[model samples]
Target: MSFTLEFFATPEIPEVLKECLRVLKKDGRLCVVAMNQKDDPTLMIKLYEWAHRKFPTFVDCRPIFVRKTLEESCFPVLDSVEIFAWGLPIEVVLSKICKENSKRS
Candidate 1:
């Protein structure tokens, strides 16, 4: 479970998620809670992005396409929800690990 973590610290998100998938049991689940504004770009999200670009080290995390990123990393999302955190949009996602999902084309 990663809560307000990787999306900020890890530069290789897909790789990290893929590695997680590789290490988990077939039926294991992965959960992540991070800032996302792909579907809903709010003012606070924009400000965060600006801060991130201007100060990479100070503001490491910008808004991202949470579900899209997870799916692209090869995890099949089971459940996802949007929540508010300090006026910014946050996404909480739960996904299952599957060999099929891990398969590369």
Candidate 2:
């Protein structure tokens, strides 16, 4: 399964990851591409922040945060890469459904 997550502003990431795992096949690989928030703020980042201020419910997505949530959901990350896209940093992670958990479900 593959998903491109707009981690730059998503709050329900943990719940989303859990749902993804639920539908994933046994031993299936899941790939996620998320915005990296570690770098200096770009125009997109500034705009996102502005929007967030207007909407307090907005989420500021971060790579480390999402990774932790994914692990908690029983999806162990197998590989990760950082790259630049459209002047924004992006994090790509490949994870797999844990054998034991997949079997249980």
Candidate 3:
């Protein structure tokens, strides 16, 4: 079996999953690593919140909703796990925010 990796950034996760399933071959495995909601107070979420406040629909990405989307896409999730995440210093997080803001502006 050939190996292909696809990464998508879509507001409609169900459509993305459907498209992935349609292209995947039989017996092929898919590894989906999505950052839906973080369990920790990470820089990513902080930046997202900052962006959201700046522009309300900014990066209006939707969560996968796990079970429902997978089932609908005809993909059975064999296993799932959650590892404890870490946090970053405020300066680094703020720097990232400034960079992102600059790019957008």
Candidate 4:
């Protein structure tokens, strides 16, 4: 099984991941694309954050945070990519469902 999440961010990422894991079969893959924040904020980054703040649907989650959350939710990352989306840096992460014994908090 496979699924993709795009164009939105939410604080309930872990919960969402949990739900994904529940339905995914063994060895299933999941992909997520989200806004990326840089160590040195650029004008575009600042503007993106500002615009995201104005909208409740956009959470502006960083890549590291999302990776950690995925691990916590029992998904092991397989690959990741950083690319530009509409002039804003975005992260694309691919993770797979972990073995049953490894799926724990």
Candidate 5:
């Protein structure tokens, strides 16, 4: 079986990965992408700060924490690498939901 999942903005992928694993057949591969610190350290920090400021109830605003979560969830680590894409500012891609939510809080 084949499936596709998309996440808007930065989401908690650990649980999502587990869910995918549960539903996926053997030999399936999972692909994931998230706004990383290398995207724009300032923007990443701002997004995380705003997330925490708005939703202080949850504690998943850090990327490293997200990675740890994936590991804890027992997802296989075939290959892990950090990517840096220059010339593309992340502030432009920042979601309105995060911005508005943060502002509302």
Candidate 6:
């Protein structure tokens, strides 16, 4: 499980997850808690993006499309829930490991 870490990484999420997928064991699940734009307003998300751009060091994270990113990365989202933090939307996502992709040939 990762807590507020994925969004902090400078690499694009899908790229990072691709590397992670290479290392993850078969049937190993991944859970993430991240600032999410899935259930939030565009303005709110844009404000976060603005903050991230304005103060890259201070605001290391920007809201992401959690489910889509995970799914695109080949991690099928098993469950997702949106929670608010000081009025900002956050997501708790649980994804199943893809057995087919667990090992490299």
- TM-score on alpha carbons, each prediction: 0.78, 0.64, 0.45, 0.67, 0.42, 0.77
Clashing pairs for predicted structure model 1, backbone only: none
lDDT of 5 by residue, 9-102 (tens): 3355545655665665454444444433443356646666577678866734333333343445554445545444442122111111112222
lDDT of 2 by residue, 28-95 (tens): 88887776565467786666567656775654443344465567778899998877755556778788
Per-residue lDDT of model 1, residues 26-59, tens digit only:
6778888877766657788888888988998898
Model 6 lDDT at residue 94? 93
Residue pairs clashing in model 2 are none
What's the residue-level lDDT of 42 in candidate 2?
72
Task: Identify the runs in model 6 with alpha carbons over 4 angstroms from their true place.
Answer: 1-11, 39-43, 102-105
Highest lDDT among the candidates is held by which one? Answer: 6
Clashes of each: 0, 0, 0, 0, 0, 0
- lDDT value for candidate 4? 0.66
Q: Write the per-residue lDDT of candidate 3 for residues 32-66, one digit (tens) a residue.
A: 54334534546666785566567766554322334
Could you give the candidate ranking by TM-score, starting with the highest? Answer: 1, 6, 4, 2, 3, 5
lDDT of 3 at 62: 24
Off by over 4 Å in 5: 1-14, 37-66, 85-105
- For each candidate, the alpha-carbon lDDT, in order, equals 0.75, 0.66, 0.41, 0.66, 0.41, 0.75
Give per-residue lDDT, candidate 6, residue 55. Answer: 97
Off by over 4 Å in 4: 1-11, 55-64, 101-105
In terms of TM-score, the best-performing candidate is 1
Our tally of clashes for model 3 stands at: 0
